[model samples]
Target: MTALRPAPALLEAAFEAAREAMVLCTADRVVVMANEAARHLLPSARPGSPAPAPLPADGADSFQAEHEGRQLYGMRRELDDGHHAWFLRDHTEELARTTALEVERSRTAFLAEAGRRLSASLHMRRCVRTAVELAATHLADAAIVVLPPERRQSAWTRLLPGLPVEEGTLREPQLGEVPGLLEALGGFPPIPSRWLDPSQAPGWLVPAGFGPVGALLVIPLPGNAEPAGALILARCGPAAVFTSEDEVLARIFAARAGAAVSAAVLYREQVDTTAILQADLLPPELPEPEGFELTGAYQAAREGLRIGGDFYDVFGPAGASTDTVIALGDVCGTGPEAAVLTGKVRQTLRALRLVHTEPAAMLTVLNEALLQQSSRQPRFVTMVIGSVHRIDHGRVQLELASGGHPAPLVLRHDGSVEEVPTSGTLIGVLPRTVVRPATVELAPGELCLLYSDGLTEARGGPTGTEQFGEGRLHQALSECRGMPGAVAVERIRQLVSDWVRGGDSDDIAMLAVRAPTRTPLSLRGGGAPAQSPYVIAARRGDRRPRNF
Candidate 1:
């Protein structure tokens, strides 16, 4: 046999010199050899029984091996011979770094999710609670507090786990009360009090038996121009010092929190203001038409930090012997300005009734007034005006004039919706123009629906690909043919709300009036004429004055 020139011993010595633990085992479960690293790692290695089963079959060459209290790793390879070799490598430091990375990733994910939740939440209390919990669990051992402008004491406070206990502590300073601190820091930037030793600062005070405070982090809750409140954190243990990295993360979180709070506050205020203005602008109750029962509802868009301009008004007289008129309009903007304009339009329409009796003529006059008033601004208004005249017997005559508004929808008793043929230019665009009002004869039980653009312009579907157009409105009205006007209006509101998924981009105003056939006068005959008694009385009384 050719001499095997001591290759096995040399190879064994080379393997022993390597830093990685090395072991060679035969297929029959007998240990062929083991290097110094392998010997050091496994003190019990004689001729191993199974060679620790070649690290898991996956391609990962290195993995942990927890033997006793210490952690290690075993890398494996198949030798040129049929034997298998395992190289042991300690991985304690690498594992520590990987664990830290994973923790940081989890923290980032948690913060992102918290921000989304805060943005979506409508209730301020719940949002504040959730935010505090998120920061306490993920960011640091913090005490979150929110203070309202009216509340002399702090708004709320949530103590994080492991914080020093303070009982009945009702007084805390809000950022509004600390203008000096905020101005000193320039725009209320976050400041770390940990740098100043707790014992050195005169303001640092510890509770009964608690140890000296380790760190303090103060962040201001910002609003339109100034800080609204302050977020104060107190730490106790040696590891509680607020680091620069911690301050950076806190500032980011504070920014999101401040924005969410500001948005919510603004939304609530706008809603209140809009509701008040809309209620004030619209008449409390519509005048009863001679042959009609009127029911109406108005809704503002659920968007932005402003109120919209959608309004409905009913003028003229009440009862069977009276002429009832209805008007619905939308201003082209949002917020207090639009609300102001809406109020003006309603007032103008009401005032026009004193001079004009014709619906089209009254709209024309109001249009001129609006144009004169809004000449300096680059906006216009759309309106639909209607007058109901009780004709002889149970029949009623409806006259409608549209100014760049959606055509009124008429629902017949037979479940058919007809888009009324009424179209004209928007008001406030022309200084003087003739408005031709369309006339329609309504039988008993027929209903008319007048609405603004909000219902027709709602974005549809998951991607907002479609709009709840005029066709959809017609379909919805047709579906509720036999329902009462009040019920129908409610259903329409519900349908619109659902189609928009609680998100509306524009303001919606709707008014529905149903012409009832039977008159109270039919039960009793001495009733006056359907024409205004005041006008007739005035005409009779004016004969002597005209003669003079």
Candidate 2:
């Protein structure tokens, strides 16, 4: 306050020597002073010229502005005389660094999203296509190729954008040359690439600016622990060097892709194997029976992993006879265990037939044997065994026994359907229970139908709980009355299939027997005296008096 001393010119000159641009302006936008940098930026600075338009206000200390296409940051302060002093700094390098960081962040976000989408897709073909598209879009590759394992003379090959590949043109990879690349990536196998030997590479190189083939990734697909296929990726483009990040990403994606392809191939193989086993278990065709015509069909349940135990057998004459036997049975459970039980039951039943003419006795013996031989597993079987005998002309007798099975439906010539109810508990439930036989007399042109529970228990109708019960079955049988046994059985099967509409939860086994209108004896006798029913005496254990 004593004597105002003018600022030294040296102070101004020293400030001009600094790197940042500096300037001084009055509140009314008048140029007062400027540093060398500011003078260099303008090139129009005069000793006392007016300041540029849009001068900064007092206390606006930090802000950005553009000058001659260059960005500048500045701070302003108020002077004692209501004037303003502004200081400017160039921020070009800082802005450039910030922009580069943002770009990298966006790239990382895109790669993360792409990887998630690739892993989530369940369809193998769609996942492969998406991966290829990702490589082409992000990695800037010239082409992407995937080769599956060799099968027969050819391996499966798919190129991105569907590049046309000539038949038998793709060759297998040589693994020995690329040991270093495979060793660097743990658990990754080498896929033979055509470019390994420069001479074998395609003539079409990438454009001049684009780079060489940077890397090849190979992944092995193991199906049920057995090598089933492989996935290969070829990357080439400008700046196409494979970074450490790329190797990590490719390794993860390849593992996921290999697993998906393996699952699909294994599923296909299992389906084929099951179908073959089912075919082997089923009979080629039922034998033609004589007075009574017989037709039988067997089908395995589709949902079960193995063939079911539903089976039908017609033994003896097709005609009505005291000895003709028709048997339909369903063993408990499904698959291999049930199939083995079915074989045992069939063998036992056949053996019992030699000693017992009555169906009930034969079933009792079979049940006892099954209970004794089978493990104490909670299992049982349903069966319907029937014997047809001709008593006199125009009369055929049917003796039936049911073991917890659906009663056989009898279709008469008069278009009426009747269910023949037989009494017996399920076999293998009670070791010594006796089965009760029911008898029916068949008239000329009448049919008898035997079926497993699969036909009646099929889901259908409203409530989604309604079953194709006995009523529907009877109606179907009545509709097919007087038809040939083979034709009638086939119609019944079709009607059941339609009612179920293919919703068969269990296996179906059916057998149909129809007494022919003409007697077998009449056919053999040539309209003369009929011979007696052929008799084959069964043997019994000798019971001579034992020595005391």
Candidate 3:
């Protein structure tokens, strides 16, 4: 405010002409003269009376008070003749504006914090719990969040101060018993607080031991396609009745909580769907035939996902049959998209087995079937499909067809690894894609190995970029000369894993089929030949094969 002083002659005219209310007083604290504004502002302070209480106390220079319901500001200014003037003005509008600004700031901060806390929850139940807890703490005396009904029951979470949150399923909630709840649950606009009578609230809507309700607020938590649920807020006494502004803030808060709960519900649905997908796409347990042991290992390229491009399955022969169908394949890429194609290939092969089970014939039919897909983008699968047969004299024979896949390796009894020459054109591409079929014979102590390219192509070494070539894989297998099928497969997988050392990798899969070796009573050549540790473990029933 600008400095103001009045000339003795012009003081009365200045005080009267100005809009400000001014009262002049003597050193004795007695009122001497007053302007029209001051006379109207303080009707009781006349020329002969003392000043009113609106004056600043304790010799203060300024004061603020309420006069006849109007907010007033007063200033004391001293004059040269042992007199002073009290300048007063109505400042109701300014103070109200400041108070409103502060209230808005508080509401904004509250909403921001609420949004942060709500969005952090991904589980639907936890999100509901958090919503009710927050509302109870800040918006009302108690709160409850009710989810959509299912199976003739509705799930609810409720909270109150100094008490653990409560949750349970209510059999057929009577929403009509509570005013505005049915409308809110239907996603209609909320009803004003004044319209609801606390005494009419249903007992189930209020937590136990809580006194009579003062106010109730019900609002829907909207979702992407439908309402996620509804929120119920209550106050304990008449003094806490929600104002119009309080209702508006509650609505805004409900909007944020609704969005968060909706997202959480959507995420949970996806997780459930993914679980089903993983169960279907996961490789089946490899069947162990008499005198034939098969073990396999698999790891998807995408972390946290169980299904990937690489896959393997073993179908044991029916009664009296000697051959067990084994198929291991890798799609072009290494994620869900490729895994889908891998699944299609596996299912198509199973379906085609009724038509033609021969390795080459099955490949031909699968190639034609894949080429018939409706996808615009090209997709192909590299596979090693074959059958394991336990022949006479305890030897195993393997007949397989390769479709643009890495050649299979045969581990010899003397620790020598030989690669089978069965590389062919990748399936799902050329209609006349060549299918190269090969045959290998495993001696009593030998084994046949089928694997995906993720093994030899794993990238890591001292330089962290070197590929674990076939030479390293072969050398690793040489160490597992007399090990069981599962042990050999695990050995190869472990070596590849070490080679990568936690670096990015493609989908890896390996399968090994070993012929049983004879275990003798003595270490010498007296009875049967000395058995390997794997065979001893097998006899002890402790050889647990890896789950495919």
Best candidate according to TM-score: 3
Query: Model 2 over residues 289-396: C-alpha lDDT tens digits?
Result: 445567787667776443577887656643333377778999887767787787677667666665555788877887777777748685688899888766565556
Clashes of each: 0, 9, 0
Residue 410 of model 2 has an lDDT of 76
Alpha-carbon deviation at 88 in model 2, angstroms: 8.2
TM-scores for all candidates? 0.51, 0.60, 0.88
Query: Model 2, residue 183: what's the lDDT?
Result: 30
Question: What is the model-wide C-alpha lDDT for candidate 2?
Answer: 0.63
Per-residue CA lDDT of model 3 for 1-548, tens digit only, reads: 98887677796676678877888888777898888888888887788788876875477899889988879989999985789989999888888999999999988998988999999879988888889888998889999888777897788898976789999876765757777777776788888888888789888777668888988878888777788888888999767699999999998889888999999989999999888877768989766578878888999987887889999987766545557888899998878888888878888877765544778778888899999999878799899988778765567778788899998888877787888767689898898978767776666778888999988888999999999998998899999988888888887888888889899999999888888885444643465543232211211334422111
Candidate 1 residues 1-548, lDDT tens each?
Answer: 98767687697688778887777766554676777777776765557555553344454556776765446777667766677767777666788899879877876887688788888876666666666766676666655545443544446556557663232223444342332333422345665664445444223233434455567666776655655455555576766687777777777776777667767667778878777765766445765554668888876664543346888888876344356777888898866678888888878877776555566776787777776774468567888888777665455667788888888887876777776667778888877665545766555667889998888888865666478888888899998877888989999888888887865468888898786744566575757634311111121233121110
Shift of residue 23 alpha carbon in model 1, Å:
22
What TM-score, to 2 decimals, does candidate 2 have?
0.60
Q: What are the runs in model 1 whose C-alpha is more than 4 Å off?
A: 1-123, 151-153, 159-216, 222-224, 236-252, 259-292, 297-311, 316-324, 328-344, 354-360, 370-432, 435-548
**Model 3 clash tally, residue pairs:** 0
lDDT of 1 at 491: 96
TM-score, predicted candidate 1 vs. hidden true structure:
0.51
When summed lDDT is taken over every stretch of 10 residues in candidate 3, the lowest stretch is 531-540
Q: Model 3 segments beyond 4 Å from truth?
A: 1-10, 66-70, 80-82, 319-322, 354-356, 521-548
Candidate 2 weakest ten by summed lDDT = 532-541
By lDDT, the best candidate is: 3
